[model samples]
Target: MAIKMGTGDLAKYPFLNEAGDYLRQSGFDWEELDRPDTREILERAEERLRTAVAGNVYEKLDRYETEILTFVVTLIMVKSIGLDPVLKKYALAEARRAEKFLSEDLRRQSDAQRRALFIKIFEDLFGLKIDVTEDGRLFKVRVTDYLRRSSHFHEQEWKMINRLVQAGQVFLDADETVRLIRNELAILIINKVRGMSLPTLPNSLVERVEQMRAELTPRFEYRTQVVTEYPPCIKHALDVMNRGENLPHSARLMLATYMLAIGKPVDTIVEIFKNAPDFNERITRYQVEHLAGSKGSRTKYSVPSCEKLRAENLCFATAECDGIVNPLQFGKKRANKK
Candidate 1:
């Protein structure tokens, strides 16, 4: 038998089966969403959508039931709006929110409880089994499972070669384990939302859905034209992002820095990321500005050298890249020849 989660647990992770069971057992009907008594739920749902749009976590209500219901209503609202970007954004935000609570839960539980909870959560929710080392200081996951989940991570540190593995199992600390599952959780939520069949929303809820659509829609005016002067690596990164695929963090940093080095406006660089699968305008804008030296440390960052990029597997070197140590130097020789 699977370990059952309490209402509080369900509230933290409303995507759990227990939360869905709870809502169904409560006899809550879709028509009730427009009732005056359910206005609080509707309002909370709207707030959840807005918070996600702004790239922030939605706060949980004092009542666990309210939290669970609000999550359901939020999903209904997101599904009714039927915008792909909004669905992706909400799924990402909800997953992050769950991660925050999960991290807190793991830290607060005693060692024995933490181990059991961690194992149970992974096994039950993700069908992935996790084990604690004999000393209980490290978590162990099968190499195959690690490879599947770690594919979502683009950092060099997540590469299998960099991991501590023995006897077909990869070793990771508690925090790292949690971080590895964040994308899985997001994907799960997205799948669930996509599978839902929502009824025609009441007028009140329809109006709110329209409001959410207006707010979450991308309104960027910048059109991306291929800059022939850009090196292959930068162009590849832009192509990945334009196709709405996830770009590796190193590539994103390189692209941002290289663009900034060539005097591209911060807004233009930020707009370039609008088509990213996980794009959050607020977070992207902040990061682009930071790279531009307008935020944190206020020190302009430079594009990584070709050698560093190659080491990180981010390089797409061609004959044109010859003798160019950094991406900024890619088109210089050609310009000089002209």
Candidate 2:
């Protein structure tokens, strides 16, 4: 059996060249000669249009198709403006990427599709925003309407502008195109912002995003810093636990009291309850607020309060002197590290 391959010299054809007709209708001034790259670009672009045509007429799409449309426009631009050799010989198939964002009922697309495609081609790829002119009189065009109705472009008008953008990317850093391309993106977004939902963000979202990128991306440097998190109340309770060599749940309450007495927030005291079997912020607050004064008898001026602080005689002295420092301050203070 012989295999069939499709290769034929087609200077002669049974049908007229469809691409040639569209070019003529659009008013392009070409040499009337077939160039290889131009033919390829146009053929591919028409194919994209054909694919679009076959989908459901009433279907609606919210796809971000900016890249696909941009690719096609780049093709046209390259032919109009000529190639740039600065791209190394080992470069990939294409030096730039483009897309067109649009949403619409597919059934009515035929009426305004061309104009929509044109506007996106020029505005999105060139970094131009859809806004009033500097004079403040021109009304901004909606990208969605223009895309659905094909309103921004007319038949044959976009070919030159498409070429200009493509030519620039081929010779310059393709990533730079992102800046030029997104200028108009916000205009389309403002209409939908209120109803938009985005992925979850962090408390320091912007900085965290930068941090992650810096750590994960190629050629980024990273640094480390130490931070002190302990406060005076916490430190006092912690010291008690450490002195005993082992802190228990009863002892934890003592730490909580210390924290409360020093005016630590109830929520902060609650946070210290990792091992607190019966931790309650309200109870801890009550206990820490008032230290027993002289066992209900001695006043500050009546007896030798702190100066005559006898270890065995006083009932309201430090826990080391037998006052029982809350009950949990018995074990070693737990170590925490960053």
Local distance difference test values of all predictions, in order: 0.81, 0.29
Cα-lDDT of candidate 1: 0.81
Candidate 1 lDDT, 1-338, residue by residue in tens:
55667888889988888788998899988778778998898888888888876667887658899889999889888887777766777888898888888777776677777766776667777878888777767788999999988876768889998999999999988788788788788889989989999876777788888876676555422235575667999888877765555687888999999889988899888878876656778889999999888999999888899999988878888999868888888878777989
TM-score (C-alpha, index-matched) for candidate 1 = 0.87
- What RMSD, rounded to one decimal, does every model reach? 2.9, 29.2
Candidate 1: residue 93 Cα off by (Å): 1.0
The clash numbers for all candidates, in the given order, read 0, 23
Q: Per-residue CA lDDT of candidate 2, range 1-338, in tens?
A: 12121111001110113323433455643332134434543444333322322211111122222223223232332222221210110011121111221222111234344233324433543333343223322223343323333222223322234322221222112222222332233222222222334423223323333443343234111111111243333344454333322233333434444455445665554444322212234554444333222223332112122322222222233333233243223222332211
| Model 1 ranges with Cα > 4 A deviation | 110-116, 151-156, 159-162, 218-229, 276-286, 294-298, 318-323, 331-338
